[model samples]
Target: MGHMLWPFGTTWRPVRQRHRGTVDLRWLSARTWTRRWYPQGVDLGEWQGRRTLAVSWFRQKLDGTHLASRVAFVDLERSRHLDVLLAIDEDGMLQPAPIHAGGLAWFGDRLFVAATGRGIWEFDLSAIRRVRGAEARRVAGLSGRGVRASALVAVRTRVHPIDLRCSYLGRVFDADGTPLRRVLIGEYVTADSGRIAEYTIPETDEGRFEEQERFSPGLPRMQGAVRWGERHFVSQSDRMHPGALWTGRRDALERDRVPLPVGCEDLALDLDAKLLWSLGEHPWHRVVRGIPFRALGIDS
Candidate 1:
């Protein structure tokens, strides 16, 4: 495994504990002795006038089989969560989305998720279908009503053709507080320094993203990253060890060697609340917490 090198005169700061929040109990205990799903990405937005948080997860079976990915829509105010299966529409039927879903970003009515090397998958939030009974057990036509347990599924309508090259995807906003028409993608490398790049989000339906900027931040094991104006915050995990949060300009980044949760992955910022959100990926240790900007000693 590769190690991280800090800049000279780096000061390590502890993350604030008061702002941390965990997901609902139902999904929190979904990991059993045989089956498990690791939460990878998180982003919050307003849906139906309510604050909704979306968390992505990829299933892992005990036999070393990796299954389909899903996203959980958690109602923050209500303390309830709805798991939505990520799928692609095929011949009027739904097929599992076979992607890692390493990062997620909610922009306007579209939800963008990182598809690792394949690119970014775009889903229309307004097109999520609620599956019932038999339809929930099989990835077939959405129809049937018998069992009380229902499921939700979102089908991808389009894909942003930007190759991530195994990097995580996220979104950043401009100084005006408006989300820019660009996507931030970064890689996670252990032996060598990983690079972060920005791509323009196409405006039209048939348009393609054009590379806007690229830079090597020299951070290793970068699970996720987000930017606010000139400041960028990145989550770097060192497996079982405590994670670190790197913040500052791209050229001169500062590292807080302690504070972030263990196994931290993707990151998102709630600018209105002055909070930075991220999720842990380990089973039983998983949590979706938001750290206040003020607590990190950053201007809100």
Candidate 2:
């Protein structure tokens, strides 16, 4: 986030926790202090007061898709990261490969996944019964290369159920499976100290690696995401903007942008992680950032 607009210098300093001129995000060299070290996800259902991230595996996507339990699928509890070689279907017919797996959302017991670069695959989990019927159906294929390849987010507005995702084409939407409107966001985030931060990538001789070494202050990229309350929080890949969350409400979006320190977005606020965690690439790939609804004035 320090690379949003003006570079926040070398080190990030914590500031007064208030909505003043600029929000400060405590910066440093280590990656633990950022948002990546901490994994955040949404609560599909309620067990207690805390919203337990219904996640315990490699989370690389979050486009409203869920890993459904097939007739012969393993349980989520007794699973661990397969560092070694994991096996895929020899037929490659059961699991449809999407652009990302982290991007997901649960609405009315149904999980929708932006499968591949264009298709929005839907799965039924209304009762967890037989896990059958017309569940894994694919919608129409979207367009563009980078735009279709980034990630997907379903934005619910008064007018339409919009998809706020990014490929190289920026923020476009599939309204009821039809093309509607396109909007661009000057997205930004706030650090732990509420410092204003944005994103920017510069060219380097050794590409991003050498540049990253020279300038620790790199541009933040968003990963998985979901709507928290009214505002949308997002993650920016690794640890770049992990500690900070970005909010662009319906109203503030037209006037100004409000930032947050809660990275992540796969939530509607039922647990300690009231903030939302990012999964897909709304803008691009970087340290995943989180967002809160209150910061977007949705709480008001």
Candidate 3:
């Protein structure tokens, strides 16, 4: 059984701080509910200067039958209705890109999605019928060619085009796929026994939220990550750290580890107002809201 190396997510609940940080379920408005969305590979995208979100759904088994995997394009305000796109598949069975998908990015006029073995797939929502998938080709001497790409983030937005690629061990590269830097995700105590950084990314890539930062745990596997304004949040599915939502800010540059909701997999936010939306995995695991958790006098 070959499985992608990931974090051992926890199955726990919110802790009471001396109130384990503040949790206001009201902060999240379950505004609209539609087809149950198994959201993976989440991020903010821009099409025509407007905000749109692209997410891939996990293969679902309904009534004991398997469902094909597809990508759902959502418009934030309109109706939250989903437009599904079928990805390239050889076996016709659903094999989703990594939960933490790397190939999807808003480049030029389209969204480029990296499939498991496909090099890159471009989708032009403006011209829905013009979607294109670039065949995966091997570069001589590259041991990890055509394998699944786990993550991709274009930090600079322009010239630098700094993109991060983590196929096996996390590594950084330029826009053209030339290797630049490398990072390891294991929680290895450095030669000095101190926790070495897992993935150090350029602040700019984190959005105008250059104030925000992104990184995985030294421990293998992470539930999900979201960046808003100057804060980046991740859910650590750990029993020991049940409902753990790790955070990092830019200005004060401090890390605030807060208690999140169990079963949370995706973190979304309206960062401007200090609001957060965490999507969960279970039926009863609805979205959790974090409203200015710190200012509310909540501490873990």
Candidate with the greatest lDDT versus the true structure: 1
Candidate-wise lDDT, in order:
0.72, 0.26, 0.35
Q: Candidate 1: deviation at residue 266, Å?
A: 0.3
**In angstroms, how far off is 27's CA in candidate 3?**
16
- Model 1: weakest 10-residue lDDT segment is 1-10
| TM-score, ranked from best to worst | 1, 3, 2
TM-score of 1: 0.84
Q: Once model 2 is optimally superposed onto the true structure by TM-score, how far is the C-alpha of residue 253 displaced, in angstroms?
A: 5.4
Please provide, for model 3 over 1-300, each residue's C-alpha lDDT reduced to its tens digit, 9 standing for 90 to 100: 012111223122222111233433311222212233344343344544445545544444444332333444444443232434443333643222222232233433444443322222334444332222222111010123444222211111122112233211122223333333222221112122212123333333332201122333443334544433334444445433345566654223233445555544444443323344444444444434444645523331
Q: What are the TM-scores, per candidate, against the unseen true structure? A: 0.84, 0.33, 0.44
Q: What is the Å distance of residue 163 in model 3 from its true position?
A: 12
Candidate 2 residues lying further than 4 Å off, grouped into runs, are 1-43, 46-52, 56-93, 96-99, 126-220, 224-230, 238-243, 250-268, 271-300
Model 3: how far is 17 from its true place, Å? 25
Put down candidate 2 lDDT per residue, 1-300, tens digits, no spaces: 011112223232222222343222221233223222222222233212222223211222245443221111111122111110011122432232323323333333333333223423334433231111221221112212323222112211111112322211112123222211221211222222111111111122222201111111122443333332334333343343433344443234232154333433332232233333332222222122233434445432
The TM-score between candidate 3 and the true structure equals 0.44
Model 3 misplaced stretches (Cα beyond 4 Å): 1-37, 47-50, 62-67, 89-127, 130-216, 226-232, 239-242, 249-258, 268-274, 288-300
Query: Residues 65-110, candidate 1, lDDT per residue (tens digit)?
Result: 6667788766666555556788887887777787889999887678
Question: RMSD of each candidate?
Answer: 10.0, 18.2, 13.8
